[model samples]
Target: MELPHSTAPAADRPSVAHHRPGRARRTRPDHAAPRARRPLSAKVRRYLWYTAAAVGIYGASLAYAHLEEASHQAVQATNAAH
Candidate 1:
């Protein structure tokens, strides 16, 4: 069975508009100016570094505690077997 095709011309038919090859459509208009971002101050940067360091330390301590508990359990298992 053959599908019936529209006899209307290509321009007259309702179709989705295609973007040009290798060009992306912009979300914002070209005439709109972008907002300027402020740079972080020295004190704010220091605080961020301190917070990151504290988080890393806390994660390391938790990992160490888990490993310690695993080792303690293994020792107890060995003693029970003996």
Candidate 2:
């Protein structure tokens, strides 16, 4: 009986890495330090924070107005039925 020929050497299996079979390349290359970021001016920072607070307060007031209107409508509906 003739033996079948295998395509790859047993160690260089498709499931394994092209490098060492079990061991990974341990150490990563040290990257360059990140570029320093410019800090925002105090005026710009204060303006942005104030703008955010204004938007948040406006949104809350709008939501409260809608809830208040809905409650008033419900009260009117009950009054009409009585």
Candidate 3:
């Protein structure tokens, strides 16, 4: 079978000097550095906290459902007795 070739010229190919699949690129200082990243704003941090809390609550509910059959049965019995 014929080998696949990149559309980019060899020189333009992403530098293998610091390249690996699933890893970040690290270029020489001579090359222009990438833009600086922004820090998380208060709103973003609050949203992350809320998301973590929601996941924790969901996991606790699932664990309770799996582990506490007695509580569920008591609730059913109470409803039936009413």
lDDT of 3 by residue, 1-82 (tens): 6556855478757666534654455546655777789999999999999999999999999988877887888899999999
lDDT of each: 0.85, 0.84, 0.81
Q: Is candidate 2 or candidate 3 better by TM-score?
A: 2
Query: In model 2, where is the ten-residue run with the lowest total lDDT?
Result: 21-30
Say which candidate scores most in lDDT.
Answer: 1
Instruction: Give residue 26's lDDT in candidate 3 (0 to 100).
Output: 50
Q: Per-residue lDDT tens digits of candidate 2, residues 1-82? A: 6455565567665664557744475644655766679999999999999999999999999999999999999999999999
What TM-score does structure 1 among the candidates reach? 0.57
Q: In model 3, which residue pairs have backbone atoms overlapping below 3 Å?
A: none
lDDT score for residue 82 of model 2: 100
RMSD of each: 10.3, 10.5, 10.1
- Backbone clash total for model 3 is 0
Q: Write the per-residue lDDT of candidate 1 for residues 1-82, one digit (tens) a residue.
A: 6545655567867566555634546455665787788999999999999999999999999999999999999999999999
Candidate with best TM-score: 1
